[model samples]
Target: MRVVSRLSRVPLPALAVASLVLMTVALTLVFYVAPNDADQGFSQRIFYFHVSIAFTAYACFAAGAWKALRHLWKRDPGADLESYVAVHQGVIFGTLVLLTGSIWAKISWGHWWLWGEDELVLFLVLFLFYCAYFMLRFSVDPGPQRANFSAVYALFGVVLIPVSFLAIRIAKSFVHPEVFTLHGPNFGGWILVTYCVAQAALLLLAYTLYRVELTGKRLDARIRELRFA
Candidate 1:
């Protein structure tokens, strides 16, 4: 709790600057430093961005669910808004996952989308399910009822994360190309370094955006209270 509060106090500018620097470094590593894959060739470069964004989306959704749990179980005063902001960020990143996945698919499989792919279809389902969260959240009047509804929905939606993540492995049908196989990771060397950098960059970017949105919403609430007063 103390740590979280301290983190919340981190300056937005610092986070924004860190995100920008890391993102530039990650891009450089992805394009210039990472060697071309023998199998997928240059097109494999998309994996760095696509997989990192997907993982970041997962992190955001998981964070939202954790905040929602705090709101419901602990009755944390600020958790509701935090959960909403996290989920909103998740949706934004999820959209990127879809777009990048589509591009990867086009390059690898010669299709914009592959319905036969378990991972792709499951991710789409997860994305659409969360998309409904906004509708559910906005339908109720602001108060405890709205907060309760949102919290519960967030909790329910989070269940899909693991399911979607493991769909490729579990499904008997055609699966998306598995980067991490039972034997070991399919690629190594600088590819792993590039992936790690990309993941860090996207997570930092997501956190910066989450904090910015949360701060704006809190300010809006304060302004509303002042007007009412």
Candidate 2:
């Protein structure tokens, strides 16, 4: 059996420093080591971070849902807060995805926003849907009821993800009569390494940000409690 107490604790500052170093190295690899594609050229370099951010956003949402489950199922004390923070991070990354995706679209196509872009449209829908979560959360009084509502809403958001993707796929069959195509570059050795590094760096960055935000929130709550006491 594995010994749970055998694990050593790593400080948040150390994690933050490590994340920063990894990010720097990953960025260096992205700019210096990865080759420009013959098809998309230098603009394709954006794919490293753009796609990575999108994946990270998905992960954040999944994590939020898991925390929400904990809040509802186990009645975990801090699970609601953790779930909110994860959703918050997901929204932040989702916004980045929209911005970077627009840039990529412009670079690939001659336009900034394409109405026929299935992925873009789906992301926009999800972005708006999750943005409403903040409104819903703040509209209610803070208590167990709020926690239950938030948990249920977060679960809905996760379910919406795959459903939205499917809806977009179905819509694409008839939506765009003339399809605009942007192909990803073939992944060679260095390119694959750079992508993996970039992905790891972004995930680490997201986790560090989540930890920082959660810490700030906990501190705020403690201060409020002390003042009231």
Candidate with top TM-score is 2
Q: Any residue pairs clashing in model 2, and if so which? A: none
The Cα error of candidate 1 at residue 110, in Å, is: 0.4
lDDT scores of the candidates, listed in order: 0.86, 0.88
lDDT of 1 by residue, 1-229 (tens): 7876786788999999999999999999999999888777888888898889988988898999999999999999989999999999988988888888888788877899876555566668878988899999888999999999999999998887776657645653444344422122366789899999999999999999999999899999999999999
Q: Which stretches of candidate 2 lie above 4 Å from their native place?
A: 1-9
Q: Encode model 2's per-residue lDDT on 68-102: one tens digit a residue.
A: 99999999899999999999999999999999989
Residue 194, model 2: Cα distance from true site in angstroms: 0.8
How good is model 1 by TM-score?
Answer: 0.90
